[model samples]
Target chain A: MLKEILYYTWGAVVSFVLAFSVGITYMGLNRKVTARVQNRIGPPWYQNFLDVIKLGSKKTAIHHGVMHHLGPAFLMVSSVMSLLIIPILNNGRFYPNLNFHGDLIFLLYIMTFGPLGMALGAGQTGNPNSAIGVTRGLAQMAGFEIPWVMALVALMIQYKTTSIVDLMNIQAETGRWLMFSSPFAFIAAIMAMFGMFRYSPFDIVGAPSELASGPMSENGGKYLFTMMSSGSVFAFAKLTLYTDLFLGGADNLLVLVLKTFVLYMIPVLYGVVNPRYRTEQAVRWFWGWPSFFGLLAILQASFF
Target chain B: MINDKESQKIVDIIQNFARKHSLWVLAYGTGCGAIEIPPTMTSRYDAERLGVRGAATPRQADVLLITGYLTTKTLKRVIRVYEQMQDPKYVIGFGSCTINGGMYFDSYNTIKALDRYLPVDVYINGCMPRPEAVLKGFAKLQELIQAGKADGSKKYKENLEWYRANQKEVIPVWRMPEFNW
Candidate 1:
């Protein structure tokens, strides 16, 4: 029992530290990405931190019920938990003993929990704008989920195990990276995940001009900071996952950083080129034909 | 009792999402006062430094910083933009057009009160308000941010009469647009 407790405790601690570091890096990188896209210079990495602190000192107001208040709290909880699950660095060497068996699938599902909680809380608060935003968000999730699941499942089949550690190990051995062997599989996966990350084109949820930050309309102070941090860390984890999975990680820290940054640019570039997807269009296209290919990849690996 | 680092980090994250990274400006630049938006945003006022930037589309922003005047014609677009904006959104009336109609009180071209069409969070005064007045409005918004005084979400839900007033015109239980739906 003590050993198990120590393992989980270590997991949480490691995740927190790693998430913090990568969060800073991505904050800087995203600024540059957005700045380039918007024809302006974005703020420094530490700028995000300063803004959060300033808002944390803002006035506090409670909405509808204790539930509305709890919304941000729950959102933060889910985001941190999701961050804790990604197999960053050599941490995957700990494998099934330390981590859950079906962690990849679990992590993906848990990832949605934070956003879902926020949406639900938005519903409870009863802001029609957010209500509309959350509705759109849920629809988009429904759209992209099939393609995402299909892409990951295809990869999972190739590794012949749902354990993320095993998948990483499989990649480590092949000398044949999945992205190189099956570039289509890789692109499809990234696109779906990228959409889920809610940058630019998929930014229908808190479209500030439209929904006034959507479900985030009511949050301020510490709660506001919490969401911002969650967003940054979540994006970091997402990019790291792509790097670790698709681009292949190196033993050297600099190599790993470089790979992550390149991978990060894919979505950022996509954002610059693409316009925000109307909620209905995002959903319709998400569940459309591209998802079919992802499903095909999975079936090919599983049966053929 | 709040020793949970996880929750604390989460709270910090939520706050940052609202304040720091993407301060979404509402799309509709209605009223002649809407002209001030350019200087305040692009260079002179530099709202960008405060993480305030205009979102070309409504679905991407959080703060709908309305500049002024709601002409009857523009009122349609203003309501449409308000509707276009996604959740967790905020509405600010930039000038006289926002509060009880700045100078268009007697003119049929302008809506008497901007709030009559949409919920207004902060109202900055002046015929064509200076950027300083706009800054004060932003500061007041910052206070709301500081105090965490966000009843906009809850109040909007429980009693939507205010938002309804913005979305539709009420004509004393008569002469209202009849929807066949």
Candidate 2:
């Protein structure tokens, strides 16, 4: 009984450390890359850590009763738990790694929980501001996700397996990244995915200027810290997942960093060019034609 | 004496330490003013040099800068978030919206002045201010931080009676879900 407790405790500690470090580091780099693209000297690489520390220690003011408090927690818990199922690699290489399939589709869907819970939590506060933020969030989720998910389906069709291991092996044998093998589907999914990341123009929901941090307005102290840390970790996790999926060719950490940063930059650049989408206009843009485009990409992958 | 208020003081001190250095904006894309926040803080304008950033959650924000007009529909959410923020929190009214309602000042649906409901410190003027102007606001905030002000906590400690009554009388946005005035 003691042994079992020790084992579980040890696993929890290590998982937290790994996820926390990797998550913070990647977001630091993301800040830097985003900084370069936007033409400014962004915060120190350790800024996310500093930010979380501040949040964790602050005075927690709970707003709108219970839902606001619960929402940030719900959003955070689901994201941190996802680490358990993910295969943490010792290095970026596919062969010598502790990789697991991590129920990839589950990871994607559950990740949505953090944002959705946040949206609902904000809504329940009876914050009309958050209600509007929720409306915009729902629309953006619809627009980009259709293409992103459809592309994932296309990739699944090609691989014949959903397992991460199988994905890597298939790539190694074929010597092709999905980006190279099926550029359109890959690009569509990535474009949509990055758009969903809310790096820039896609930041239609949670308009800080408008909604006052949207749903998170009422959350303070450790509750707020958890949300912030989870988000930072989530950002890094996203880059890691995308790196493994597309840029696995580089042999070393430095090379991997270069490729990953390049990929990370694509969306940050989008921040420079576009402005926030009006909620109605954003929904309309996705409704009729873009969904059709995603369908086309899936078809092209299958036929061509 | 770890009374609820005293324990809160220690926590408040640490939170302020964290708050002064790194500020983040929430994921909310509520108003057009959000568009300008990113570039000022990202690589393009790099708001980081001044230690200003757009965070994804309120837990991370020190200054809840309200940039645009708040409608009856949105004010409740804003007040709730303002409540969620840790004490010693600083609020910046970024444009006309939070001050006198800006363009929406006379609108039947919008709140007249944010201060009618919540407390505020700094104000950045513009419909949608330029990145430079936004950063200037950041710089002003930083200067206050350097002076050890870090946005006061008085509003939180002020006798509750005034605000409770004011919330009811002035900012009816506090009453229920949405009451079109």
Please name the candidate that would achieve the greatest TM-score relative to the true structure: 1
Show how many residue pairs clash in every candidate, following the order shown. 63, 29
lDDT of 1 by residue, A1-304 (tens): 9998887787777666666667766766676567656665555566555555544544443355676667777777776776666666654542212346788888777878887788777788777877888888888888888888888888877776777666666678876677876565686787687676787898888787677777877664456667777776777677766766676645555676777778777777787778888988888777776587787777667765
Model 2 lDDT vs. the true structure?
Answer: 0.66
- Give one digit per residue, the lDDT tens place, for model 2 in A1-304: 9987776566656755655776676667667766665566666777777767766655545556677767878776776656554434423332233335646677678767878888778777786766777777877887777777776677677666666556656676777787787666666666675556676666777677666656555555676677767776566556656666655444554665566567766777766577777776766665546566568767876777
Write down the TM-score of every candidate. Answer: 0.68, 0.67
Docking class of 2: acceptable
CA lDDT of A108 in candidate 1?
78
Scoring each candidate complex against the real one, what DockQ results? 0.08, 0.32
Q: Write the per-residue lDDT of candidate 1 for residues B55-166, one digit (tens) a residue.
A: 5444444677767766666666555555544445577777776777666678766677765556666778887888778767777776675555634544555556666665
